[model samples]
Target chain A: MRLINHIPGRPAALLLAALPFIMIFVAYSIASDIRLTANPQDKLLPAPTTIVETAERLFTVPDKRSKEILLWNDTFASLARLLGGVTISAMLSLALGLAIGLLPYARSLFSGFIAVLSMVPPLALLPILFIVFGLGEVSKVVLIVIGITPFMTRDLAQRVMEIPKEQIVKAQTLGASSWVIALRVALPQILPRLISNVRLSLGSAWLFLIAAEAVASNVGLGYRIFLVRRYLAMDVILTYVIWITVLAFVIDWLLKSLSRRAFPWMEANL
Target chain B: MSFVSVTNVWQRYGNRSILERVNVAVDEAEFISIVGASGCGKSTFLRMLLAEERPHKGDISIEGGETAVEPNRERGVVFQKYSVFPHLTVRENLIAAESFDKPFGRLRGTARKQAEQRADTMLERIGLNHVAQQYPASLSGGMQQRLAIGQAMTAKPRILLLDEPFGALDPGTRLQMHDFLLELRDETNMTVFMVTHDLDEAFKLGDRVLVFDKPRWDPQDPGLFGATITYDFDARNKGMPFQDILDQYPSLSLG
Candidate 1:
């Protein structure tokens, strides 16, 4: 708490510092309000302590292969699809953005199409995608790719356009060919912003992943949530939700750390 | 043939005329300075010579027997703003000039060695040898401009075009740059065309000064933005040195 005071007025740091305590207080309040069943053998309400004990048992018990399989299967499946979709989106968007931004003809030709595509939300196209790619991994991954690429492309293209005209002019004056100028001057200048946009898209990509997995998926965190929701298993749903949050947090943190390490100059500007 | 001939050049932007039927000729190993107010088409004229802008009427020709208009290693230009690439070190900036020799061709082995050696020498000449490995952003404005000059000189161009190269520097550093440029000119004997608003800069470095005034295109009185040969002085005048000519024009004072 004293360390929190040393952070000056950073609201984000303060909020993060308060999160665990707030969650604990909420859990305590919810636990106190639970009602027990009249029948001794049949439990109607599970205590917050019982939920915690169950989670601990799930982790510590080596013999509980079923629980482990249930957790690992969905988690790994979701992660694999998320990674594949994001990777495809990132590569395609970056390449297309650079091309469009650098070349006037490409910009003129593709800009309108891209604008139209960007306006259509990926979720809106999910039904159509499902019809086309079928109710499998391909369809789910494609949906996520479609969701993320447009924003990424727009951000990356805008950053490329914002590269100072003087840099290009100077490069040309120094006898650098168009390709050299694009590769050396333009690419490096936009890299920091591109990395930033990639980090931003990761959140949206995860959101799309969950939404995609919720429909026609048998093995995923989203599927588990759906299954638990049918039976009103709020504890399992909460656990999976927590797991998703942690994974997203870790991924986002890693991306930001990588960005900082790769481009130290970006830190001061940000 | 004059070393560089700009004959009856007219530059315009849309309907507004900037340089109206201007003409000037530069000889071998001469340093010419164009001095004028901000809107008097000094930059436009430089752009015309650099082939960045085409004259609406008239032609520019170089005396070197080359017939076709090519982006030559023969004409090096230094802009008012230090146009050195922020991402590149001074050495990289210098090495980049070699690409102009043959479009899209690589410089390797002994040829690359020679270019590097030349770049190193030029870096030393510009007194930026210590900062050869440093990016332009890390250098002072004066140092960056000097690095730009070094980058230009690395290609060993026949004529150098400077568009108010020291305009952004502070007065003290401006004087230092002026002295270095003069010393460089003395050693290299390369022709230089500079545009400056500062009268002292024109007087100190120019072998001949061209003063531009707003052209009056009244048909009855045809003075326009095109610069006429208002005053041309040979810096090597026996009794009257450049300092004396500068003294004559009190309006061109450094202060």
Candidate 2:
């Protein structure tokens, strides 16, 4: 079989995507068996059975203290923060991006500033964010916002700039005011791009969210993973990590499909 | 008196001169076609009329307005590409053109119905009623251009500026568009200022054909001055032979 570019049928394509995952599972199972044979209580390599049990317990059973399914709670909290930060950033990016792109004065004022802002490593400001925003949900959400907003704004601003000058000029000739041109002509065109940008920025958004939760929060998938690390709870950690991966994949897929369906005209070149 | 007048207009980009002292007086409902060599300021002069750019010296007055400002509904333009909004369906594009100045681009019940009715009529006129619900991307080049022209005309602009509107179409499609434009102009009595590289197109559709070129070559200050109306021919006068006009401006006559 060729290593690349072979057009596989549906089942084969699914299998091809699942290949690496299956390999990892088998390899880990074999290593776990070996370690368990040597020392049955080894925490480093948990068996598949151990991971499955942990997943079931985490998903179904309630936390002893809070009487809530910790897994679902973590999922909800993380998703809310992620979506909140991303939604705010998307709106801000659209506004500032349109302004910076369409107006010469705004471009001159903000383009360089935004470029420099994006260059500052967001993680480096984590401690300052914690101190300033008080390590609450505000700081966590703000971290994700600050972490992704500048990059998104820059991306969207560049996208706005790339909007053919003809479109803007044509909008003007159609008796559209500047407001109408920005909100109507430019906004609809950039929304699909915004989705694409958010999809690309999802990785960093997850990173900042997890880092924030791991450092300060008592709730979240990240906090749970970090909390269990001292006990060397590899089974729970591995399950949580896989769940997070699944969630990220689902979010990205949903966004991509939404963009494709809602804005079919966007993929003209594709 | 001229309905559209350009007096002593000059255009410069950095040190390069594109247009200089261009004067033209266009009566109401007059179809004017502008032709010139590549980089000879035909499009630049058209841009001035569209109010996309201002002349560094002098002014262009449309319908007695003394100074050209940003493009408005009074002047409609069709570019070679992207004249239609790709995101909107054909009907929506026409409606948008009609409703852009309305509050929030909304037309109330009867107004909305009336707008849709007008859009449908225009769709039928352009023979695009079959694809009224489709997006511009799905349409062929000729169909899309027709939609764009219909969209621009739905707003009823006093003048239409076409920047090589058929430059990208096939020869057959170009001829078809030529007839469509002539019919539309005759029906609406719309004044048109078209810029094209096709001399035949300029002569075929224009009531008055203008050629912009550098009349005097200055070896010392080559870029100091710009193109001007070097030749003006009355296309409505069929007695004035094509070869005679071509003989007057040898640089402008080509395939």
Candidate 3:
């Protein structure tokens, strides 16, 4: 048990240890494909060297129009809206879930309503939101909130409810009041699950954001992809897709890192 | 006057009688242990004392002015399964009693500091000061049970109730905890009422032992379940050893 405590960073260490093997596999596949496709005069398909060069040029060079498009204000606009929507959803879900989950009467009253609400897909409600709020930030933000909150609320509430009754009873036996039991005891016990749910909802929110932005929007990466699709500019579409994937990856990584830092005890258990 | 009194208490569960016509009294600072077979209402009696359950046919009164037990800070309870919250550190568990400001009378500034200081002193007394910062999950079972004891005692309650606090531990740890509890009771002189199944434990720590027997049902009195107190013996006998007492009550032997 003493030695177990010293073996920190196991997950990160395992991932680090596996990275070289993954890189080797990818390199072997690329090398084999390059050797097999010996036709040097293939004009339609860019060589791996050219693709790498294009990627390097896009990242390193400052003046290219394609590079400018990649680093445009539209990207920031989309990111800002994504951040706003996710923040609102996270806060509202946690507050509402805690209220309903911890209070028995509230749970009885709202549980059915939340259950029914969760089954309705947000995409199906897109038309209704567009009609109510119209084509602007309001509808997009509302769509993301509506899309994410129910799932997060349900997940968080269930997690909160599943905390061992002994923990709460123990606190009560110590003379802790209802509020203290909820805030101090119950909340901390379910925090790991809460954070994991938030991470899950972040991804869901991003997926909803793209679908939300695809309709009635002149800006954002989604709109950019929609516009480039008409001209058959697969490169731009693929580039934005890659950018979105990378952005989501970074956000997910940051959230996980925050969870690890905030809860060293959870890290130890894991 | 008795420090704690239960008068003609009859507790029934739905259709079954758990404790029937039971009465007991404890003087101030007295250590009383109740031992009974499984499902023989020993735990039910403890619950009644803690006010977690109500009696069907009679009344229970604390000598302190309160007529009914109503979540008072004056009574502290330690459970069998070790009810310490896993999220809280040992010190936090001790100070948890401070969070109930209504019972403690508006803890603020100097009062809160004093309470915390007293908790630290209790940590030292329980020999858990080294694990003050450790959560209950990280502590060993014996350590966790000791922490539970410290947490329960931190409120400085007038009476301490132990519902088989050491019942879940192995024999060696159980004996160690029993000794620790005995030493603690000697130092504090706090009134204790422990409900246990271990007769030896009852003999070792209790100033007086109350033995409860299984209920007997009679056809003539169909509604009345007959339960009786088999014995109430002085645990502080000087001339007779505990083994001699066990010899007389052969049923009370551990084997």
Using TM-score as the measure, the top candidate is 2
lDDT of 1 by residue, A150-173 (tens): 888887888778776545555656
Residues A1-270 of candidate 3: C-alpha lDDT, one tens digit per residue: 687686548898899899997897578557646754876544333444555565565455654554464445567878888888888988887777777878899899888998999899999999999999998988888888898888888988887787765455556566667676677776776677667877888777887788877887878888877876787654456567767889888988888888888765553763
Question: For candidate 2, lDDT tens digit of each residue in A50-100?
Answer: 899999999999989989999999999999999999898888888899999
* Each prediction's whole-model lDDT (CA): 0.76, 0.89, 0.76
Residue range B1-255, candidate 2, lDDT tens digits:
689989899999999898888999999998999999999999988888888998899979987787767888888989999898888889999999977887566568998899999999999999999988888989999998998899889988889999999999999999999999989989999999999999899888998999999987789998977999998888876526574777678888786
Which residue pairs in candidate 2 collide? none
- Candidate order by decreasing TM-score: 2, 1, 3
Task: In angstroms, give how far residue B172 of model 3 lies from its true place.
Answer: 1.9
Q: Please tell me which predicted candidate would have the highest DockQ against the true structure.
A: 2
TM-score of 2: 0.94
The positional error of residue A98 in candidate 3, measured at the CA in angstroms, is 2.9
The top-ranked prediction according to lDDT is 2
Q: Please tell me which model should have the higher TM-score, number 1 or number 3.
A: 1
TM-score of 1: 0.82
Q: What is the alpha-carbon lDDT for the whole of candidate 2?
A: 0.89
- Residue range B1-255, candidate 3, lDDT tens digits: 788887888888777777888888889888999998787788888777777777777777878454444445667888876477666678867777676534432367887788779878989998988988877777788888888788777777777888888888899999899889988888889999999888888988988899887557667754467355667878876315474777789898889
Task: Evaluate residue A179 in candidate 3 and report its C-alpha lDDT on the 0 to 100 scale.
Answer: 76
